[model samples]
Target: MALKKDLKQKMISEIDGNKNYISVEIELQYQPDLIHLLREEINYIGQRFYYKSKDYKLEMCGIGYLLEARYSHLEHDEIYEYWQNIKEQLNTMVFHEDKHHLKFFGGFQFSEHSLTNEWKDFGMSHFVLPKFMITKENGRCYLTYTDHSHKFDIDNIEEILNIVESKAQARTVSEPKMVANKDIQSEEWKALVTKVVALMNESVALQKVVLARRRKIEFQDNVDVEDALQRSLDSNEASYLLLFESGKSQFISQTPEQLCQIENGKLYTNAIAGTIARTEDESENNILKDELLNDSKNQFEHRYVVDSIIHDIQSFTKQLEYDKKPTILTNKHLYHLYTKIQADLLSENVLEIVNQLHPTPALGGFPKVEAIKFIEHEEFGTRGFYGSPLGYIDLENNGEFIVSIRSMLVKGKTATLYSGCGIVKDSNAISEFEETDLKFKPMLKALGVM
Candidate 1:
């Protein structure tokens, strides 16, 4: 605390001495699992805020936040509506970067599995510099964010501090309180679970039937979107949405697994399903991996995911590649079989494939349509962006979409964390409940859920 306080004081002093400039560079050395927590889901857009840091990460390109939506769910469509609206929104709306509004990318989508090693091509990536970048450089995961307020002077720090102090100095708002009741004891959810269990018993081939629960939190403060996000993210909670856009463009996320990424023309993807937390030691981790792989119920649950992604990409590209076997990625919290798949993306832009690939079995279910239907009416209220793609593909469409897992929706100090596990026919609700406990690690740690 002293170090951070001193650092902030020094930074402010420097700015004050400068008299008029806002060239501030802030860095946070995030922990490893914490970095992965950020990686768990990708929020492509937000109202308007900037944050960056590099702490702990696995292996991949380092990415970071660009700019907030200034308000979540900006009528950004105006930027593309007729292409002329771009100028209108620019004139009226506040964007992260004033000059460049969007980016786009072109790549092929494959389902048959091809390009397992070439991840840079299809692996998710972002332009970290010139703003923020989240990716792997060296071995550690690092995120670098740059803030250049056009409103501030570049030569004088005081000039910049004046604006930031005035704009960003809002008092930390209070946490929103939620009301829970005994309604859950005999709630429809209890009945829904029973019906789902019955369905699992009747179906011989069905692998997992993951179910979810929802509760509402009323928004209280007239808080800025960035404040809402910071409260949740700084806490290590599992959720991806934060009340933004003055309560309009709510930040929603749906990530738990890497579906696919395409760059240049290569496709990169991972197969993530089946899980168990670490009991400790390397051997303990290995045991969990083995159990997940051999378990019929687990395997069946994972296959649905593998099949969904494989087929989703097929609609866009023909050439593909995949590792004959799935590799287990052991995190402190859980284990997942991740197979690297790649392919030569066709001439279509990246969005062509992304549009069809979201909500794979890892999130929805085997059959996308059926799963979505079940989730919508069965999972309580709207999943909103909870299971949806929550990252940037850029205006150039050259960005990665992370499965918004291990995340939560933060409206204020109080936030809601969410976790889900694929429930196969043999899946026990109690055990699956435990699985969610493990999946909750990333966000839970972030949100102080523990």
Candidate 2:
């Protein structure tokens, strides 16, 4: 209570004293579960974002709209330029750093021109400078607020603080419930995969294309986003659990693939492909792992990802390095072939590098432009933010992005789950269909459907 009062008084004093945008952060001694707090305190349908990494977590509520960028109906090449314009605006804004500072949280759609009206709230690309944010790192928690108007309302600040304190003290754990689930266009999706593989085998300029399917689940009562996120965090501790809410829809995922990360003048990312299921028996698990490593079809699928990433990033990187052999990354439900790539960055613009490397062979396909064309024309449903990049960029040019996979979009009682698998010349339609099913297990179990 004393800390809240002190923070309120300090915010009021700062706003009264400054003419420019005011940003303040106060460290809290006690740690609170971020998603639990969000579920209890956030009243608005949209204007919420949650991110959890292995070492750090951030939860943001409310939107001050200090700076926002949205673009629709833009070509692939033009999108990067639009982002540069937004970055220019962000560069001019004055920020006060206190070891911990606020960053823009958002992501781009899978395709700018292909985005449907259903995802109007997300736009082609969107990012927000949240009004209030809670960040936890290194065993400490901090609360931050940004006042773009330069006039703080002490009463509202007090209310927010009170809610935080109450939620921190009286946390309740919710139980998961089973839901009714249906696979949307199951047979059609399998047929599409078969066609794609046949085309690839016929040498139709498509070597490898990834196909996705959606599962719609309905619950008797309104689904709790926090509970769903908690389940993901508990199941996949090594992966990134993220949420982005816009209007009434929330996009959430627990992804193991990192799109890109730049730190200390170096760039790092991974090639994560070639999926196999994990078994309860150690011997069976080892057999599956070895099969994934030695399987020619899986290796061919994975090499495209590594080669495409390396080719795309070579322009901006001085020295690139990666392991010769990919090791197996095992989660609770599955195993993936993983290879780490590192390089010294030659360009300070990290977003530019991100643009070039996004939709790698793992997500899109080989011969990038042609594969995208086929996906746009052949895919049965909209990709929305699935298999796209989502993360934050700081003032220091250091950021991390994860490919949004093993994800779902929730609206009220209904949730739409998304999963995809890589298709190659030897890929069988039935096998690919089964692979997508395996991919769906993470989100399915998280939603209490499995």
- On TM-score, the candidate that comes out on top is 2
lDDT of 1 by residue, 1-450 (tens): 122565556654555322221224332243233233332324433322222211222222212223222211212232223223222222111112222323211112112122232122121211122233333323433332234434433333233222222322335454443343112222565556566777768974443455654433333343233433455456442222312121223332323455556666677776777666767688776677788778776666777777778888886676778776666765445667766777777743544455577667887676677655666556654343344443444433345555656555555433445666675555556665556656555544433223
lDDT of 2: 0.76
Q: Best candidate per lDDT, number? A: 2
RMSD to the hidden true structure, all candidates: 11.5, 3.3
Prediction 1 global C-alpha lDDT: 0.45
True lDDT of residue 125, candidate 1: 18
Candidate 2 all-Cα RMSD = 3.3
